[model samples]
Target chain A: MKVKSIQCKKCAAPLSLHGGGHRIRSLTCEYCGAIMKVQEDFALLGQFKDQSHPDCPLSLGTQGTIKDVLFTVIGTVSYRSNYGDSWTDLHLYSETHGYAWLSYQLGHFTFTRRVRYLPSRNMKQLSPREILRVNDQPYQFLEAYQTEVIHVAGELTWIAKVGDTSILRDAISPPFMFSQEETENEQEYHLTEYIDPEAIDANFELEYDTHRSFVHPAQPFKAPIRKALSKASLIPMALSVLFMFFLTLLNMGNTVLSERITHSQMTGGLFVQDFTINNANHLVEIQFDNAYGSRFQVKDITLFDDTHEVFTFGKKLKVKSSTISSQQGTAQFKIKKAGKYTLRLRAITTRKWANSDRITPYISLTIKEGVMNNRYLKYLFYISIISFLLFYISRYFFNKKRWE
Target chain B: MPNASHYINCPQCGNQLPLTFQYAKLTVCTHCDSTLFIEDDGVRLAGKQSVLSTIPSLLELGSPFSYHKTSFVPVGKVRYAHTIGYWEEWWVIGNSGKGFWISVDEGDFAVEKPLDLDSRDVASIPSRDDLYLGQTITLWKDQWQVTEIDKGKCEGFQGELPKILKVDDVVPFVHLSGQTGQLITLEYLDTGIEAFQGEWIDPFEIKREG
Candidate 1:
């Protein structure tokens, strides 16, 4: 389709109509800001002067291919929100795909196309945070604002003036945003998708700032490694916990010996108990309990195989507190020999207000075998949980910033 | 099945024109750009239509293209000039021996098939003045929103067409869109109201068949 070159009706400035076909209704002169109605023999519509041009990099007739469709920039409209935020929308026309828009704001670019699908609810009735399904995809309303056409250049599909305002509401479903624009006469819906600045640059073969200052609502989070880690850690984390639970149920060993020693049975402050060991493949536990408030101390606990000391644990255990009715402690060790094992305990007094020989405490001792140590499994579970949290926390913050 | 061919002489230029489709009502003489209207009695020269200028396009007359895995050969085309620009409707024949219209307005493309108003329980269609943009109406057992209401003239034509069209004939058409991409077009012609039902086609999906 060829566009005829014409002079501006108001300023007589030479202008070449590169595109927009017959759909564009108004052509604005970039020199004197004169808007002409293209259908009415280029009649002067209005003059909008003293307006600043937006920093748009794409000029009229700049051709680019987006999603395999070739489009040319034919018009530009600069719009300002009610809150003073400004952006530029470049009108794109393709000979085969009709009109579209490339919006640029804060170093971000998004492609927009008019959609016939009306929102489930009216634009004015929708509030922020409300979810509306369009084409079965959920879109959450982001904001509603008034957009004023501040400046215009090239050609537009409608007769846009400097102060033409429309109430625009936007809803986002990541990678895609649905916008509803309502004027006094008509309501229109447009679908926009966030385009990476690098993609825009590559498509047009031009350098752009590409330094986005804020996260766009339609921009998808791109942390592939973190997302993969978060998802991949879940199975192993669950498996580690399940293994620990099953290990605890299956490793409860039985007790082999239980004995009691009286205080008067000590001759040289030594009490001996002979216990036979059955299985030496697992761990062994020796537990002792003494009468509470009895001022006594155990000097040494030794396991001897026919008077040959196999293991000696010499730790002083004192029971002095009167509040505790009984004092208990346990010691664990690995034993190899399965023959007769004799355990000996040496006792002494720790109190000065009583007779040293008569204040010996009565003690009860028990020996258990085949116990399983699960310290390594417990550490593995903790590590798995921390690794998952690290990835999850990063992704959570990334999403939070995107929504903000 | 046996294939049949039809030929006619241009009343204006005495040039022989081939009418490939049996239902072809109009054809343009390639030698003199004369529009030949085929009637039940005989062919007559309707008028001289302007020759279409060369432009980059996906479909060409006598060329086959595949859309949605179905091959269609364009036999004729009619260009309608609107207020801002022009749109072309191509008369295409599918591999199944059915004929359809492929409308290309700027970049918008639609494959439209003629709809019988009586079969769809539609007794009448609203006049061009009675319809407005964004207005919804029930037709063909579905609700359609009026997206555009425009009047154009038959500016130029080429090859063969399925309907009798004269040069500079006023064509008033209304476009309605469904919730999905379905489209219903109503053309108020001199004879009667002609309706077409179709869906929007993505231009990228059309592949030129060799």
Candidate 2:
């Protein structure tokens, strides 16, 4: 509420020093185009006439709280790059905290503060992709550009001229940027962080263009849920792998019956055997081994518990080659009762015209119980891998957009 | 140590002024704003110090404030005018009965304590002519980078101070920054060079006491 009142040295217009404390050096009259040196009895330094004012939502002496510190907008400097890019920087001041900058460019806002920490190398000497460390954190060099001051108003920490030019270099470690400003007399470093438009609107209560057409280099990626899910997916992925390992270890079951049936043991093209299943509520596997050249077909294999039939399985087997080889086939079923079971198999041999002699073949059969099934865990492991990849892929593209 | 109840009459205004600290060297008369210099022989009138403009500040003269759970009362202040503007340093008495300095420049704040350097250490400090900005200097086994080298003059004073200061007397100083917001300042005084070491303090962390 307390401010210094002075009259313009040229136009005699009333002026008020709202902030910048005792450190400000110059104040420019908005009514007339005269710049006065505040330290030297309001002496006229120079004049900038017919300069157009840039679009700014906040006016001089507008108070706003940023990051828990109340600051007043004391000055506005509009700059234009050689590439035709223009932005406005608002000089902010606090009684207890010092001076800072709120820059608005392309519908984006960023808050910047001068930092004492020095970069590892000079800003002009840095190459693209080269990292510069400030306060022990790495920032990648983004760009370097030349900007000239086009318009200025109100009070500033230093003297302002309309045509003053400076070179600025920027480096980013996203959501944060390190900028180096170099002029003819001085070089300084500033650390800037991106601020959301909603936050700025809430604090300053200004309505301007809030639509951003491109992602800012300092804007943070907004997919927090995806990032969290990416981190959380590792837990399920690890558990599934561990369970698959344990299932593999318990894959082989106890062999309950192993027998060989000769051609002479068969009666009327049928073979019968009695097997005792010791473990119930387990997967029972029935496997058969035969010679490679045999053309015998397994018409039916039946399992009976006492008088009722439990299950039946059948397969036709044809030998494609006879080059001193053998083959095996297996069938699995879950057994619920631990009791004596009878197995019956019916087979028929195909007759060939070239061989008149009866070449009867023998078969080997094995039965086992308590084998583990790991089909569902395999599917879960695949789904977890897919989820992990999806989250990271989205993050990668988001970062790529930011850098681009 | 001087008596806590020690009082002196201003030579210029004839007002009673209290010497609250043991090493008090100068006290400004609240009645007429005359600066009084305390010497071994007697108190002498230095000059009149200009009253600074009222600005909302975190620490005020004679006001107790708590920082990092420790309480301190600012007894005096000296404002120095530089090329850019001005900065003020407050002389405060801590809860432990020790005196320290808190400097406020623009928005930056620092709490400093006087540090004694040996003859060898004093000799190693670069002269004012040889120092440059961004140059590194090793002190107290730590590397410090020179941030600013400026020459300022005493603009005014208020309350009491432990150092003899005159209005418009030129004082050159260099500011250096170390790891973790640490600061080291070297002032080129007429007697010699004086050094103080401390760390930067956040203004928000200071809690004012009524």
Best by lDDT: 2
What TM-score does each of the candidates earn? Answer: 0.74, 0.67
Residue A24, model 1: lDDT of 82
Q: Candidate 2: which stretches are off by over 4 Å?
A: A1-17, A25-59, A80-86, A161-163, A196-198, A206-213, A220-223, A255-368, A375-394, B1-22, B27-54, B60-75, B80-85, B92-102, B108-160, B165-210
Best by DockQ: 1
For model 1 chain B, give the 10-residue run with minimal summed lDDT: B117-126
- lDDT digits (tens) for residues A283-315 of candidate 1: 788888776334556667788998688776664
Best candidate per TM-score, number? 1
Tens digits of lDDT, candidate 2, B1-210 = 223548899888788877877678988898999888899989988878688776667788877899989989888888888886788899999888789999998788899998887888789888978889989888768898898999888888887788888888899999998855789899988889989988877675688886
